[model samples]
Target: MELFARSEKTRVVEEIGGVARLGELVRELGGRRVLLVTDPGIVAAGHVERGEAALRAAGLVVERFADVHENPTTADVARGLAVARDFGPDLLVGFGGGSPIDVAKGVNFRVSCGGEMSDYRGRATATASLLPLVAVPTTAGTGTEVQSFALIADAATHQKMACGDPSAAPKIALLDAELTLTLPPFVTACTGLDAIGHAVESAVTKPRTTVSAHYARAAFEVLAANFPRVVDVPTDLAARAGMLRGAALAGLAIEHSMLGAAHSLANPLTVRHALPHGQAVGTMLPYVVRFNATLEPATRQTYAALARSGGFADAHAPDEQATEALATVLIRFLRLAGLPVDLKPLGLDERALRALAGEAAEQWTAQFNPTPVDPSAFERLLNSAS
Candidate 1:
């Protein structure tokens, strides 16, 4: 089924300090036992303690799985699954960033359905109903909370596997923008860029629908207005709120409309260069935009609409002019965020670039690009960026 068409009883609540109300929410969902999944960073940040207090105060049993790493792998999921089995929780609370939230979902899939993550690659593959999940995201990036996909990687090969199912989508997304205030500037920049890339890429994918486009445009408008503010001044609460809401909206876009070449291209760079996902996507996005703009007039028109949505160009501007405007603005964002805009600075050579291009072509998202992409198109994009 199409993602937005699914009839899950999902709830989204926006509260500035909603983590403190987790206990109340869990009770409303009929959760007597809770497994709280998170990484060590969030524990150190003290968000976990507050959530634990709330759940405990509400008289719920809770367990902790705190070993998730960035780009969580199969090993990470297996380790988390062990904790879930020991606790036998009736519900899950994913209390950190995307990694922990995804780890929680991964654990739920295996524990409830009795299989590895690969068995549930596409939508609605779960053999049993998964545990109810309440996601309290601590960062403004990744946007995995609102979507059903769990982006776990293979431990040996580092190939990202997007495991998705309708039953695996979060039952509640509890937003509290104040939790984002403690992030370091670089984490803030990288995650914010990831959200921005989601808005831009989902706007023009081949299967984009009217509902998804509405979310993409709304996400782009808010992200474009707030990203720079948060990057330049991390303590700006208003900008932080805008970013959190924008990321969630973008997550909804990716839910209904899968992403495009930028995400497909970004994954290879991340696995090969050990680059952060946001930095990889940010560096390659402008080049992909320029490459896609030449595909056809309709694609060019879509890019133009995105440019106008960001206030980077006038509504009446020609498609070619607005397309370039969007590409230029993307590069400017790289400069503003202090991220590399090309592959040369990363020390990747022609051979390495060629290998990455080949891997990029095999990614699931590549086929969703409005223009059909092969290794040759990816090679051209990488070479130009380099």
Candidate 2:
């Protein structure tokens, strides 16, 4: 086994009432002017107002930029950047789901680095310093707060851009499970599955380091045990807290190992159909798992072990049986969450499948899949998901 260099840095402060700490966090960061990035839904949920109050109480000048969309477009980032420039915020507060958090990262990069979104398309792309950022997740999914990357969509093409740099990582992450209680059932389901997809993809990626695998395995265990419980009882704060921690762990996993074809395939659905990122990825996860199972026996065994440890199968089960059991458990969970079990439900046709497959093949994550997945292979996976 080859040993790869590991660079991991995440400051995640989590609790049931972490939002209350926002005031002190801003003071610690010495931020007087702040920009809060979010969406209308988050504002309606009152998280934005709560965050604003915390900042203001801490003696910071707070500006609200709530125009972030479901799948954040480049224009959204540009608009937020314009606000940041106008406010000259000493700090940025990302206060919602992944879309807003991602947009905040992009805004920070653009405002400080002085470039278009396309200029920093790959890893470690920040050429200049960035303002300090704090992330507060209203949703339990996406874990964007713990990552050093941002996914911004192109305005004209709707293609999600994967931009990464150390500068994009938030200086602090505040995870308050209380905020997640207001999430609707469908949103809970989709985001939970997104966390599972992250763990699974991280486990089997070509760049899977020991550190990544550790985080992935822990994330998988947390999600596997708690996601169903949360779906069954949405008001369970303990279950919600578990899911939040799981999502954060998965985020840490992906930050190191990256993701795979599931994410690659999921991006196009958001681009074309406007599907939620979690729902799109959850729909493709089982197929990606089955595809990855065909790799080396050791790889398959590792995945199976992860599955069994996560309670997807009995510990005594054979690797093949365990793998199949894991896939079945995932599919069942998705169905119970009222998510689309097939592409047909999502209104995907053969032509769209081909287009998405071609698009998936070009994604940066596809290259990291343990198995060599080409456009044709992705097409078959799309059909299988359908």
Candidate 3:
């Protein structure tokens, strides 16, 4: 395993109201033509108008592409690409949640590199210089603002693709808690739970490193302590700040170590059931945790420490006991966020488990799981969750 790694750090300007400084930050990139890519919901929230106001105030020529859809497909990327072509932007600003941000990167790939999304599925496939992106995340999930990889699905097949490149990473991440304040309660729960999944999965991946371990542990701590506060009181600015920080750290952790079985498992569920990403991931996380913990003594200890760091386990508990407690707490998180903990409620019975397992075993992140996960193993986990 390669133990050495480095990240192209995104310049983070985090504050209670940092979006107001977005134009100033992007001006540092020296681009006069800016195309802001976002979704209608964020437009409805008025964050796009605020971002436009800031960019225009800084003497930049701004164009808007605000029709992004959830789980952005190549179709969404192509639409944004057509807008990018017509507008000819020197800079791209992703001004919403993960979907919009991923679309911006997908558009960047096409407009800069001149190929389909499949052409850039793996890491560092882009051979052309890409436009700089300023990501202003409106949700405390996916942490797309801090990541180089864009999770775009295929328009026809519905397969989610993880396209990564060193240059595709955001140049600046403007995290404003005020921007996240308008996320409705269910959106809050779904996104926050996804961040929690990022923290948990990255901590114990087979390739996890010292640097990733630092990010994973810190992310888990902050996300664990703050997820409930934001869930209970949507207007709690302090909790939103903590969640934003935690999600960013989780994104960095994912950059270094990647994700694990939980994310892999979630993808198939999301594709098949149209379950929200976070809800699908959160529902199966505890089962994946239990499956991973028992694979090796070292991995068990690692999960135990991660759980203890989040105060979900006793300091002196046995590794297995602590890991069990961790799994239980993960289940508790799903419930706290008003998300489902199993597949039963969605009306999928045991018959649906076999095919889902096959698809899950094929996910890109599945290879990085500490335990070598085969379809049978995934089937077992799915059966357990069901």
Pairs with backbone N, CA or C atoms under 3 Å apart (clashes), candidate 3 = none
Lowest lDDT sum, 10 consecutive residues, model 2, at 1-10
Clashes per model (N, Cα, C within 3 A): 0, 0, 0
* Per-model TM-score on C-alpha atoms: 0.96, 0.94, 0.96
Looking at model 1, residue 352 earns an lDDT score of: 92
Model 3 regions more than 4 Å off: 1-7
Candidate 3 per-residue C-alpha lDDT over 1-386 given as tens digits, one digit per residue, 9 for 90 to 100: 12112345587778887777878888999889999999999999888999899898998999999989988999999999999999999999998999999999999999999988999999988989999998999999998898889999899988778898989999988889999999999999989989999999999998899888988888899999998899999999999999999999899899989999999989888878888888988888899889988887888998899888888888999999999988988888788877777888877676688889999999989999999999999999998887
lDDT (10s digit) by residue, model 2, range 1-386: 21112344557777787787798898898888899999999999888888888888887788999999987889999999888888888889999999999999999989989989988888899998888889998887787888988988789987777888987888888889999999999999989999999998899899998888888898899989999899999999999988998999899888879999999998888777888888888888888888889766766887798888987788899999999888888889888898777788776788888999999999888999888889999999999877
Per residue, candidate 1 scores C-alpha lDDT tens digits across 28-124 of 9999999999999999998899999999999998898999998799899899899888889999988888999999989989989998888877788
When 1 and 3 are scored with lDDT, the better candidate is 3
